[model samples]
Target chain A: MIRVSRYQLVLMLVWTVLATGILTMPATMATFSVRDTWLSSWGILLGGTLCAGLAWCHVRLFPDRSLTAAMELAFGRFAGKLAAVWVVIWLVITLATICREFGVFVTTIALPNTPEYLVVALALACSAYLVYLGLEVVGRVNEFLVPIAAIVFPLLFVLALRWFDWTPLQPVLADGWLPVWRAGVVPAFAYGLEFSLALQWVPYLNNPRALPVDILLSAGISALVLMGLVLITDGVIGAPVAYLNYPVLEVVRAIRVGKFVERLDTWYAMGVVSTLVLKQAAFQTGLAEAFRTLCGTRDPRWSIWPTALLVWSLAYFLFRNSADVSRFILHTVPGYFLFTAVLLPLLVYAAAFFRGVRPASRAGAGEARR
Target chain B: MIGLAVGAAVLGVLFQGWQAVRYGDGPGAGAWTVWGMLALAAVAVSVVVQARWWPDANPLGWLAALFDGITSWIYLGWSA
Candidate 1:
């Protein structure tokens, strides 16, 4: 079993949440709750914390097993297998969507003439290789890259402060709480529910007991970063943020720190891509592990290539363009994710409670005593 | 585009076939075969749709439309 420190896991989760959410959340939130977009981010933080708390409880209940194994323990053989399969499918789809979004972002913002599939293939190839190397390498890569993101992200926002206008965020909650609630639901489910995926990693951690704390810390940090991004984007571009494909990139491009600091979008892109790699690697690792656990494969590495290829194909063919991708993220993903991330955990915990399932270690001790 | 699709289909089949032969019969091997077949089928269908029947029949476009309709319905009811 590969062991990763809680710090590494925290960094990995933070990068995973920030890398993707930063670029898209602003525009998505602004679309629904124009001036009160920042409030939606707070909603994500709170919702994510609740999801993370539930995941932690699930992990504590079955300390020795993965999420799949725990599901089997809680739901019984056939039904648990069915649920596991569904979760695996959801994980695969999430991986594909993230890969697709990364490809679209890179192609649209940077590589205009290059084919989107090529970018996706290259990105997936790198992430697949990381998955093959195993989770330790993924954690290490995040440890190295996340600090750079941490530095560049704030600096980019601060430099863009020159264009910040308070009027756009004025008359906060002007649209009533309903739109804010709706707007918050997207990011809340997208980023918050991501902690549910992290449940699978708990068994591999050096200190699983620290997971809830790490989850809360990562969620808090990511939420603050997202809030900053939304605030900066809305403050800088105002209502126009909803119109731009990548409001963060646009904000970065608008930054004119002195004369030489112009066109920092390349730097910003590098940071984003680093996070993308981390996110994709983390998801790919989870997918490979899920395949190994579900299919009874001898080696998880064997599943990595097949999963990567499937992700590549799906990402390539999933949406007509980025707009379609955005629509799915906004309109569809939350509901699906709520089922898997929030409701599924609650169900598993309730089932485990009723079944009187003890922690694996305690159960083993009892068996030995008998 | 046709060549690319055909190439992807052929490559997927070959890759999966190689894995099945190397790994022998197991769940992993079966999964490889299934994924390979799915890829092959997807590409083959895309080629048929785009190259022969309708010149502008983008498989992804069709998929996007279907997905959008389903998701919109799920989230906002039929009126949306």
Candidate 2:
């Protein structure tokens, strides 16, 4: 059993904040059919945090068993298998999309000469190897990288102070609230808001009761970081940010603090690598857990390679290019996140309420027998 | 397994180089070329190190992976 302190858990959340996957969202959010992009972006905080809260509630209800196990209990054997397959497939696509996006970002800004596919393949491979090392190392690495991001990002924000125009955010509700809501889905699903991945590893918690606090705290922190990004990006780039493909990168490029150590985009590349790895790890963990529970693995750690290969193959085939990948994620992932992370848990909790499934009795040790 | 991963990584790198040469600033914009090579190299090294050399040791690979996801979120959140 890998032991992780509360501090380490918090560090994990902070790393999630730094993920490159979320970094790419502002560009998508800008196209959100709304003038008040920032407002719509902030709206995700409410929806996302509520989803996190629901996850906490489920953990409280199921305690020992994970969300996957709870689904099996609530839905029965056949449907449970169906749900598991959907989730596993969902996670794989999510990983691939993010991997492809990371590749796109790198090639777009840093290395224009590099092949985008190579970047995608390399990112997936790197993330898979990292996942294969197991969770404990992942946690500690978060502890290390999270601080760097926490410091660097704020510093970047501050240094870009001169370029900021507070007036751009005015007339905030200029285009009604509906567009904002539509835009909110992009960020809500795109970021670490899909806390469904938490269900996979929740069973590994040494003290499951303490998990509600971890989940809530992590969710809150992620939202705040997100809000900071929205506000800063808007203030810095203005409304035209919505029109650009890589708004944040462009904004960073636009920052020139008067000669000597400008072009901070390369430094930002480190931040990108950190986040891509996190996204891959979370999805891979979910995939590994599903395999462990369903297939009865002799060694759970051994599952990462085949899973990586599976994701690599799928990503290679799923969509011809980034635009197709974007379309699939934009249309499909939000509803899926809404269902898996929030609705499913709530339904399960409601069932647990009536069916009398004790939360404390759901442990892996206990469930292994069933 | 490590050897296989390394070989795939090498192929990925070669492919990346080929794409970069063939389609300089094409629509894919060389994103595939660069990231593909990186994915292959990084995955190959980490797996070889973990699976072969220190199979039981928990090193820092997992945290590195999770951090990747988190950074993506942060990037998207702040980018716009």
lDDT for every model? 0.73, 0.62
**lDDT per residue as tens, model 2, A76-140:** 65566556655655666677666767777788777899977677667767777766777666677
The lowest-lDDT stretch of 10 consecutive residues in candidate 1 chain A is A361-370
Per-residue lDDT over B1-80 for candidate 2, one digit per residue giving the tens place of the 0 to 100 score: 33563565456445534544454542332443354345445655665565567666533234224333443342344222
How well is each residue in B1-80 modelled by candidate 1, as lDDT tens digits? 44454456456545644565466444444654455446445655665455556654544454345454544443344212
Candidate 1 lDDT over A166-190, as tens digits, reads 9999898776877777677767776
Clashing pairs for model 1 are none
All candidates: TM-score: 0.85, 0.76
